[model samples]
Target: MKTQNLTVKAVSRGLTLALSTMCIAITSACANFSGIHDDRQMSTPEHYTSSQSLPAERGHWPSADWADQFGDSQLSALIAEALGGSPTLEQARARVAAAEAFSETATAKTLPHIDADNALTRTQYSANALVPPPYAGSWQTENRGLLSASFDLDLWGKNREALKASVSQTEAARADAEMVRLTLTEAIARTYNRLALQFVLHDMAEREVRNREAINAIESRRVASGLDTEVQHKLAQTRLSASKSKLVGLDGSIRATRYQLASLMGEGPDRGLSIARPALGMGNDIRLPDNLPADLVSRRPDIVAARWRVVSLAHEVKVAKAEFYPDINLSAAVGLDVLGLGRLLTAASRTASMGAAIHLPIFDAGALRAQLKGRYAEYDGAVARYNQTLLTALGQVATQIAELRTTDVQLNDARDAQNATRQANHLASLQFQTGIANQLTVLDADLNTLAAEASVADLEMRRRDRQIQLAAALGGGFVDASVAHPRNTPAAVAAR
Candidate 1:
């Protein structure tokens, strides 16, 4: 009786120790909870400044829808269709779903596992004189059932850290999806702009061809009347033919650009959608913001993804560290067994069992240490990658700003040159009509005018290209509250 009492006391002491350990662990974990960083605190920029002399204030890119800025309803419709139908976007969304599933699995590891099982068997025993009386039964039936549960205690926060890592990865996947969306938007916008430019160049080429034909006719009449040499007539013919060839090349370019735009819009190469010429009067009116906030880093989807990846790697390092600590698990089972099916549910035939297990890594040839080392290295790599991505994003913004400014100056100069050449061509043509100037002088003025016109057209296209670059650099549109938390929100920014 004393031995049994001592055993009881020992069991009570063990239970008390386990409870105390659990309470201490719980309190420690709760205390650490306050250390979790508030993402909102990181949303605002530490500094804001405007660097350029532009009239617009340094701010987030304009929120105006890029397609609407072009004032083309058809372009807007095409962009909408592309966003809805693109296969790439669909694939990105699927990746997000897969990451979410992985997160769910990780979270499940932190919870208890339960299972139910049952079995039945029949046995025959021979009636032998040497056998005991209880074994003399001819036939016997047995039944068994069990309901079991098991759970691992997060003593070292291993499960919690793994779960947190998974959640961070899921957020990164979401940011990747947003990146795909932004890329698709930029592609469609740039393609549409290219198509517009192609049309403008094609029109200019046709105008040049017509002008060359008219000049060739005048030279041919002069040669027939002995007023000009055959060599001069031949030169005029050659110029007309060259202009015709250029017009053909421009036509091919326009067709190719149209096909490309169709493909970007998720249409077949041979799709018959026609793009009309853009109304040409709006030149260089788009204003870019000069001063941007430092928090602009968070606005870019790729940057947000990189940052989340770093967070995930940080959690991974924690999980790796947890491997150096002991792991604990608890398991229990309650069931019944009986010869008769009716007795299976009775307490008299029931059995109950429970167990606790602890595992410590004493030695594994330094494998755990190696794993921890690798994870730390990965964490360092992630931090470096995140910093590099931030710098690259800032560089892109700065480059676009400089390009926009330079393109504005070039466009202004091209317009001035075009105006001057047009006036000179008009005067030269009048002089040729009055026989006060030679045909060669008229041809030179006409060539200069054509070159200036083409330059202006080219500059206009460059300006549009610069606008697209600026839009991409500024994270595709105006910043919203959600832009400050790209990992949590899937907001679309219009490129304008």
Candidate 2:
């Protein structure tokens, strides 16, 4: 065998992207990048005590089993089903799994890697080349085997920063999944409450239909006896028709709410048929925690996810900056090349090489700078989204609380009006039986009672729905234990 055929040549060292010393010199003389720096910083939010919204209190943050607090087993079961089967939630989980995979790859980049490679092939040597013997003009079988090992030195912390960015991204994905869960549960609860309200109103609609029928029948008899005109009878008939139409609308509404509830659960329309009427009790004990706006960062999943994105992008900015420096790596390889398979196992065929390599972006015509700028832009966008989500979350909580308070007062008034109307209708009936009041007066009183009852039902549903909204605004029982920048409020940063 010839010398060239007996050994293998390996490129194990040198600065990457620079083939020779001349290339490095040329690249060094090409561009000046001292001004390319990312100086944008993330914003710190203002932290306030719980007294900003309400007085400081303990045992107010929603618990994991907050759904059960509504005192409805069916609602709990439905929420459980939705959590387990929701396609939206499943997509969120898939994103988390992908993030975890990326994290694994990033972590692997920081560690040493070793692998074995082997190959068997037949090749014809060139007859007029550097080869000197019988193998020069003949086809020969060659066997090759090698083992390689490599590790990055991470001198500029590029790999380390990349790993951190991956980990932060994974955390953000996980928090996003939690946000989906919170949203899904809240939607199901709200839809269920709507269904219940429709049922209550449906009953009222039916009652009005019956009352109209009675009035229409009385008007028919009065017209036939020449005691009332056709106009009066037709007006009563029109009222009866209108009441029946209302029942039709309410029946459709009940069905529509059921369909909406089922869709929210990620199920077919038929699944709505299995849903029973809601028997939910108000979760009056649920309230804001003592450590609010300060602690809220760790409670709301959207806010937490947004903050994690900011953190991840911040690390990416570091990684981009590190890219402007050199990447140092160590590599080693041992291999044997022999024309005869039997000689592959012999010591004469053994070959080995080891060296360190450096990869530096000496010249790319501003590619590195562009990458760094892009990373900073992404980081800034994440910061903006985090701040916006924080503002929106606090606003939602406050709005729900205010709306619930108003509903409470309105509910009380509605019940009072309902009671008074019932009394008035009862007194009107008594007067009619004693001939002190006309039938029209009694009928008017009954109509007023129906209207008052319907208003009370509507308000009651509003109150319950608002309570659910408040619970949802309170993070729907989801709390992140891993608080990012919990101590880095504006005040703390200013003090620092």
Candidate 3:
């Protein structure tokens, strides 16, 4: 877009006109119109608190490169793929582009506008018109060309305020895109974690089945030798069948989760089945800071987006208020007016005019007032949403922290139980070999050990799940660099 700077005199004249119009409108409505409220509905707590044990160390704000902390190269690659290719993220980027274009449009309004015009026509005068009968019945050819320029002096700073509102909207759109990126990364990590857990469970089920087969073998030998009842052998066979069934179910789960992971990475569903499974229990442990920063709430993208919305609507309210004044427009034109094309360029055929126009809203059926009222309501709604987003972010972080701590306690207990069961099983095996324990007692010890192993594995999965949730709750290390420089997140980067 082309742009031209405004002069001091033009600016001053526009401002004077705007102020005088606003004065008249305001004074006339003094008895009927009430002023707008300055207070807002949302407030924030200075600090976050929990009803459980204090953390040994407080968590720090996540870094922009937070996904790397997971320590899984495959996961990092997957996240990058999703960020670069996901359709949802693409839509967000498109919205940012649209907002940027709108901002440019608003910016253009504050600058000078110029146009080149030209026209040629042949016409016959009407006989019954005011023109003399001799010329009235004659045909005439006319040629015209003109260069026109106009500018809306931002009187009352209305146009400038409109530009500000557009800028705020652009910022909001960018924050929204960042939010989508963060969410996509978190989803990929969770799905990958679940896929790994499914593999662990599948392995566990296989081992359980082998254990049941061994038990069945022992029971069959005992029954054939008349040392155990037929009922005992049948029970062992039933246990073996149950273990096999569980293994089958776990296989199906693994396949389903793999498909989900593939979709998250922006690939075909079957692509997940071919993906290499990352090793379990390899994720980096994110430590909580001893004291959470109050400003950490601002790190959340949705909160930032909501805040921008409030700013945009606040500007919109000003724009609406400015509408109460007259629209002051300055336009000028210089062109040649001639009867033939050959004379169009002659200096003597030139015509020129320059003037300014004022459109006062003497009567608009209260339309301007209604528009201003709507803008105010929108501004209030935006404020409330921003407040709600901040509160939700705080609550999520708090809940995740508490759950992480509880998981640690439960994991410790599970490990202890596994150790005890292992020792007990070893003693029972030794006693049976030495004829001090019955076969049923030895079998019971083995079963208990198997159960204990499964319990430990399940707890480990839960612990991993908690860690994932905590990372997401903490914004997963996303940073909004675009807030400082809109060009930082270029369309080219998003397109890639």
- Cα lDDT for residue 212, candidate 1: 83
> How would you encode candidate 2's per-residue C-alpha lDDT over 225-287 as one tens digit per residue?
999999999999999999999999988888888888889889999999888888877666545
Better of 1 and 2 by TM-score: 2
What lDDT is reached at residue 41 by model 2?
45
Quote the lDDT for 28 in model 2. Answer: 54
Candidate 2 runs further than 4 Å off: 1-52, 55-59, 484-496
Q: Which candidate number would show the highest TM-score if scored against the true structure?
A: 2
List TM-scores for all candidates, in order.
0.82, 0.89, 0.85
**TM-score result, candidate 1:** 0.82
Summed backbone clashes in each candidate are 2, 0, 7
User: Model 3, range 1-496, lDDT digits (tens) per residue?
Assistant: 1232245456656766766676566646432224643445434435335323334364566665665665777877888878888888989999999999999999999999999988888989888888786678788888988999998755657898799889989989998998888888878877787777777778878887888888899899999999899999999999999999999998888888888877887789988888787665535665775544344445678877887787777777778767766667777788899976787777899887766666556567777777877877887788789777877777787777778778778878988999999999999999999999976677778778878887877777677777776777666675554433333222211111
Point out the higher-scoring one by TM-score: 2 or 3: 2
Clashes, model 2: 0
Error of 3 at 103 (Å): 1.5
Each prediction's Cα RMSD?
7.2, 5.1, 6.3
| C-alpha RMSD of candidate 3 | 6.3
Candidate 2 has what TM-score? 0.89
- State the displacement of the C-alpha of residue 140, model 2, in Å, after optimal TM-score superposition: 2.1
